[model samples]
Target: MSSEETLKRLALETLEQDADRIVQLIRVQMDNLTMPQCPVYEEVLDTQMFGLSKEIHFAVRLGLIDREHGRSILADLEKQVSDVHEAYYEHREQLKKANK
Candidate 1:
């Protein structure tokens, strides 16, 4: 394909990989029983997500990716993160119920 198309594809792949890293991080924290409300945890997540958003914005402005595609990437990551939180909470609740 054309050089422009190659660059755009690379940009999208990089963003998706970064998003996967964030998801893996959250999963690791949940596996280790790190409290979601912990200040450090919150800060790390906020910082990482903010950085990703900036990167996506840069790619969009560079014409390496479209605005809607960038948004979709972020939205998918957010939904995955939310699902992780929900699963963690549900598991915790089950543990509590089992103990009683």
Candidate 2:
């Protein structure tokens, strides 16, 4: 196979492997109790999340996959993270109200 094809295949495989882990990280962050309480924890979590995003961008730029396709996939993943965050906060608010 051509180099481009090989890269594309690799990109797909990497996405398959890392996508779940990325989402899990986001879920953990959303549900984290101590993240807001600790500046260091928040910073570390942010750094790791952003780092994963950057890695995906770099992979596309490096021709690991079609740039447009990779961007679409990343966009979907971002939306998922947003949804998770929204749900997490909503649940937290409900819990707080219940305790009142």
In terms of TM-score, which candidate is strongest?
1
- The per-prediction CA RMSD against the true structure, in angstroms, equals 0.7, 3.1
Residue-by-residue lDDT tens digits, candidate 2, 43-93: 765675577677778887787866777677667776876787678778889
**Model 1 regions more than 4 Å off:** none
Among residues 3 or more apart in sequence or in different chains, the pairs in candidate 1 whose N, CA or C atoms overlap within 3 Å are none
- C-alpha TM-score for every candidate: 0.97, 0.66
The residue-by-residue lDDT of candidate 1 on 1-100, one tens digit each, is 9999999899999999999999999999999999999999999999999999999999999999989999999999999999999999999999999999
- What C-alpha lDDT values do all the predictions have? 0.97, 0.72
lDDT at residue 79 of model 2 (Cα atoms): 83
Candidate 1 differs from the real structure by a C-alpha RMSD in angstroms, to one decimal, of: 0.7
Predicted structure 1: lDDT: 0.97
